[model samples]
Target: MNPKMSSPKVGFLYPGYAAEDDYPRLGKMVNPNVDVELIITEFNEDAHTVEALSEMGSNRRIVDGTKHLVGKGVQSVLWTSTSASFVRGLEGIKEQIATLEEQLNVPASTTALAFVRAAKAIGAKRVALAATYPEDVALLFKVLLESFDIEVIQFASKGIITAAEVGTLQKDEVGNLAVENDCPDADALFIPDTALHSAEWIEDLEEAVQKPVLTANQVSFWEALRLTGQFTPQKGLGTLFKQELPKEGELDVIKS
Candidate 1:
């Protein structure tokens, strides 16, 4: 409600069981003027499959959460879960966004789509995945990225099923994971998990791996700002914010 603290609010409908402890850390790294607020919804930490994620994602909790955030003066909404959106596939995820926008009258997006867009922005044709989800869940993400023409050169399932557990990782540990899992042919390394906090050390991770490292939480924030036309190149979040994207989603250094 404090006008000074809250301008350009970005609403995130985050999963319930998964802790969004990282958003605050990343918010501090962004423009202090923008407000990043999260509304938690139902999620099954034990259910790491597509069916489970889809069912949970289909529940009205997303719409309910969006409404709650909009009341808090958020101008945009992002369903901040990768599995939930991709489990439903491309069309289903787009439908989710449509429904969110129709109900809230604000531009909306999901973590899966955000990853795709983020990768495209950097011209990442082949990426390596460092996922906290199981292999099955990670494969679903792979399919989703492939839908956007992004190839997963390598993917490693950390086998960390619960979001609560992934939330326990420190920034250094997260950065090590990004660097360790990066494959030779990958143009970028992707660490997707709202539960995992990567923004705290994304810049360092990029330097360690010698490649762009994208995280779900980071892109979720970036995509939200872009959706609201409030995206600016900021420090600490990662390389994604350090560059600009052309009209075709290619970075200036890359020609499509």
Candidate 2:
């Protein structure tokens, strides 16, 4: 007889700028019991500007993206757009999540929301930020984090508008961003944007910042694990992966 399959599938409503950017990293980071699936949404903007990412989170667009993943049997779905969800305001972000759960009929989340969960998991009250997003977009992300009662001790937005440019950032550059932007009061440093590859530099960046390092792709993927109840520590992925939480808990998608 063939061996039984026990993997729990999780869906990602990935924005276009992050098109196919995080799957490999996720696959490497998750346990064998968790399966990763992607459903690319309509995001025409190549830039990480507030206007561009915000448009991508329209109810019509995000709902349209989940159909395929829903059919794939995902236990939970995550809107993997970080900046887009918080670009406008928290109320819009709340409605976006409500619409997702209502339409998809499953636990739903977003990278912006996941950052909060990841921070809470590590008990980080104050976090610093480093981002490839423009100054305004980065500030919006900070606002969302602050809504969760997480303090923004320091922030450095690269003011780079395009994901194409962010995608081209070097490891040393991200490491530098982490160190340069981190504040002594911060318990963690967050690097938002799945478009910029941080999975490869997480450990090194954490060492540079001397605090836990959370990134877009890493937190979103880790959120999937929590939503699906796949509570396994991912070795070598950084402190976020090593978060020690209760063995079981409700999915940290959206409360409102």
Candidate 3:
């Protein structure tokens, strides 16, 4: 770690086939000063339904994995799987984050909630969505983003049902879907699935569409930056990371 870098330990609660290298690699690209450690949960082969994802991230499993990361001195913990986190909706997401904060004694977040904050960071009101999740899971994500005031102008997905399949999806396919689904009138384009391997694709896709592209893992890194109070804007990553959130206690502004 560089002496001048702010070394905040981050915990990632991930699902099977978790791509650990991509996250820190992406983090360094956006902010080279952070140290990210991952704690993966056990995800079964069949994760196509809300019930299955909920079971995969049950209190017992998440608490166990989260405690291990807390033991390692992480200051913030994030549940990095969109399906596992959003299967419960916004309120459920809130409950899970609260649980992690209480059990691990650290600030916590999930990929879905991270997306909400990420969109707000960039001052985005209308967004286009892309996903690799099953239809039900993707709809849940859409509903949650809407709760955070993001209007879904357009939507598309690959319909990948399994965690393994989502993990193996090609970068080209992800970027293509984003470009195709993104609306010209939308303020930003969002791909809210952590399993989609989006770190390498976000920059190019943003250029292809000429708009801000947000992926679940990218927003996770962005949200971690905010929680740590390190808000330096970086270029070429995306509009969200390149802009700061509104100041504390300011009235929220509405976009037309």
Candidate 4:
């Protein structure tokens, strides 16, 4: 890391208010040297339906939403909603990142892509998913993971329809979901939903399952650091943060 780059500022184009607090808390916990800025994107509805998610992640919406971060000096920007990004599939996410880079002039990625990279970083070839979306939406994430050659050994869907409702789940509820859905044979347990709070529960959740726990907000923040080349091993955040990313050509599934 560059000497001046010790304190890097990362921007996030988040969808709504659900669990957005995780960013600042993460910045503080990782090291006092990082800055996390967020610009909440506009959306017609918070529902997890395909139509709603498509609108939320549309190129126009993402580009327009990220305009505020242009002059903020953010080293990298991330689309922080997992469901919205994955709903568009791999090609659509590539377009989203391209548009954001064109508009913001910085490295860009999404939470959906972040999960794949984070998993690969930790050598998690097989993972179990515990999603807050309905079965249909949850399956899309499975397909997204499989595209990167990562297997989804077990799947659990909560059938929750809105991000607002998911935001209300307490720590115990979130932890229970992860612990219950974890597969013993899997390398890690993945909880997909930016709305849910898992940043503070990473250690406990990992202890509960005796395996790595990858959560949306947690991986999204870690991905931002990876993009800026500022990743340093951090303790208590779970296995993903402790692992080193593969060299440039090793896992270049989606180029930053």
Residue 224, candidate 2: Cα error in Å is: 1.0
Error of 1 at 28 (Å): 2.3
**TM-score of model 4 vs. true structure:** 0.96
TM-score for all models, in order of appearance: 0.89, 0.90, 0.90, 0.96
lDDT of 4 by residue, 1-256 (tens): 4555568899999998889999888998886457988889998898998899999999888978887887999999999999999999999899988998999899988999999988888899999999999999999999999999999999999999999899999989998998889999999999999999888999999999999999999999998988887887888799988766788866577754
- After superposition, candidate 4 runs with Cα above 4 Å error: 1-5
Q: What is the lDDT of candidate 1?
A: 0.79
Query: Mind giving the per-residue lDDT tens digits that candidate 2 earns over 1-256?
Result: 0125477778888876543556656665655645678877887677776667778888888888876765677878888878888885778878888888888788777888888888878888888888878788888888888877899988888898777677788888877787888898889988998777876677888778778999988888787766775556767679988756643452253556
lDDT, candidate 2, at 109: 79
Backbone clash count, each prediction separately: 0, 0, 0, 0
Give all candidates' CA lDDT scores.
0.79, 0.78, 0.75, 0.90
Question: Model 2 — which ten-residue stretch has the worst lDDT?
Answer: 246-255
Q: Which prediction has more favorable lDDT, 3 or 4?
A: 4
**For model 4, the run of ten residues with the poorest summed lDDT:** 247-256
Clashes of 2: 0
Backbone clashes in model 1, listed as residue pairs? none
